[model samples]
Target: MSLVSTLIIADDHPLFRSALRTVVAQLLPGVQIVEADSPDALNLAVQEHPRADLILLDLRMPGVQGFSALITLRGQYPAIPVVVVSAVEEPAVMRRALDFGACGFIPKSAGLDTIGEALRSVLEGGVWLPPGVTENAAAEEQEERELAQRISSLTPQQFRVLMMLADGRLNKQIGGDLNVSEATIKAHVTAILRKLGLYRRTQAAVLAQRLLRAESASLAELGSAAEGGAEEEAE
Candidate 1:
């Protein structure tokens, strides 16, 4: 019998989710698969299946940006292994995912055989990356990693509040959305700022925005690098 009984799929694309489900079902027969299409659903799925064998995550999900979701999952469920299955197939992104605690990084463009190999490798307690990607490849900037660690220290509620703060929502507005008191929201904001080493809410917002922008910039940089490599290959 397979050791993995429960697996969670956290991607927004339904077709891709189905493809992953099929591959997993074939690889580990009888394994229970849970699908979460949004960040909230992913959180609830994790809360529900804390002992799940593995989680396949997409970086760009609704209500989460950059590595925030990965950080939260690692913070709250350290035992469960997470493998990022993202459309962004940059080596830098893969390394950043590993730095943020992913057990593996599988590009969405990978073939079924490659995906199966990655899954089997991770399931057997080994880390997996695309060919040519090193285990100790260059990671994200030190400051970004420090920010990620600080963000990881936040409780799930505090992280939600941080996201709302990034949207420039007032405390009262955030409280209304979260169904909490304004005072409670204020306390969360205070704690978030403290944990993040910031004095004002505006600073937290700017930092959060910076983290979100970093993903876009990273993708652009990856595109440029890939172009350069292609030109070199054609030379």
Candidate 2:
């Protein structure tokens, strides 16, 4: 609706990111484009560019667990809209992405014209879905939604700690990586466990793992390991 000025492209694949960037430039010439290749980088990009008009996100990016990153971004920055540009073209996945707060779902298989059309529509405050992917008004499971809400409540730093914990990082190591005292990381871990209604760090790790499994059965083969080695190592 407003003048499009800035957008964040959050995808791990450089070729796909370049394709999206080209389409975006054509759709809105002179628009500032910021690229983030991982979940942590996306978080930092959002922090650095809070007024971005939209975010183009890839669900399977390293350190991202299904819709966890989307949910967290929507929760933290409700004003900014996100569009899922992913290779996983399952209709169920597209619908679930919309249910989780993405304004649109554009399959990576889409032609450049279709991708531009989808981006244009969403940028103008419209919802977009690929052909044959109709919106399902059916609600998600109550338990799943509740968990999403809890995860969405996390502050960004807490989320980083949670993901690092999922990677089996200890408090001291997390502190060193985050550049703070071990006690601060311990506090963050405590806050994360309490907010997620868990009792221990392992539970938080398991919760992070569960978020990876949030997709439909068709995406069972897409494991966190697929993108893990490609990301900047926390170790």
Candidate 3:
């Protein structure tokens, strides 16, 4: 296959973006690099450059709710390769990223060489991950994977409705935001619940909350690791 030409780095941190840009320049010389600090910007970038070779997405960026943006990006642009680059290094989080359709997951703490290898592997149409991670699923992880599959089955519009529901938006409010009728929003809600095998809207909200908690925990762990690493370097 051809080499990657245009790459998008979607992260809110300027330092991280700069670091990644340096690595990309070193590994993939002469490639065009785009920067997006939020999900909205990322969407716009994709719309403007539909043929971008790769997108490195951060999970905790603004204008995105946990993995919702990743799911939406995969749904909308299945042709583009997206590799999640984040500080969250939890195996469960990594598994969820792959389940949500990321081609690779690169921890922020990884060395530049590892990041380069990941980008090269992804460009060569191979999935990349840290050592010791496997596709094998535990029983509970399998259930979560099934749930993620169901969630991935949602249409883009239905996914938006589900996200609004998780945000506690009323049908009328959601309809106003989507410029559709309350009846239409209600229909989407019904479909979302049915597809997710959920009984009540509250259950969907609870599921969303669980995902948020996992992301938050991962971020917390990442912060602690960063701090510990800095202390170790100082000593």
Q: What is the per-residue lDDT of model 3 for residues 1-235, given as tens digits with 9 covering 90 to 100?
A: 4587899999999999999999999988999999999878898999988999999999888756678778889999988989998877888888878887899999999998999888888888999988788754466467677777777888899888877776888889999999999888888877776677665676665666655543643221111121122212110
Tell me how candidate 2 scores on lDDT.
Answer: 0.78
Worst 10 residues of 1 by lDDT: 226-235
Q: For model 2, how does the per-residue alpha-carbon lDDT over 106-214 read when each residue is reduced to its tens digit?
A: 9889999999889878988899998776766335444444555567778878887887786888889989999999888877877776666666566577667656654
- Model 1 lDDT per residue over 1-235, tens place: 2399999999999999999999999999999999999999998999999999999999888776887788778878989999999888777678778877899999999999999999999999999999998866554455554555566678888887877777889988999999999988888877776666666566676666655642544321211121122212110
How would you order the candidates by TM-score, starting with the best? 3, 1, 2
Which stretch of 10 consecutive residues in model 2 shows the poorest summed lDDT?
Answer: 226-235
How much does each candidate deviate from the true structure in C-alpha RMSD?
10.3, 7.8, 11.3
Give Cα distance to truth, residue 141, candidate 1, Å: 2.6
Highest-scoring model, TM-score: 3
RMSD of 1: 10.3
Segments of candidate 2 deviating more than 4 angstroms: 12-15, 35-49, 61-79, 95-101, 131-140, 181-183, 212-235
| Global lDDT of model 1 | 0.79
- Runs off by more than 4 Å, candidate 1: 40-44, 61-64, 137-140, 218-235
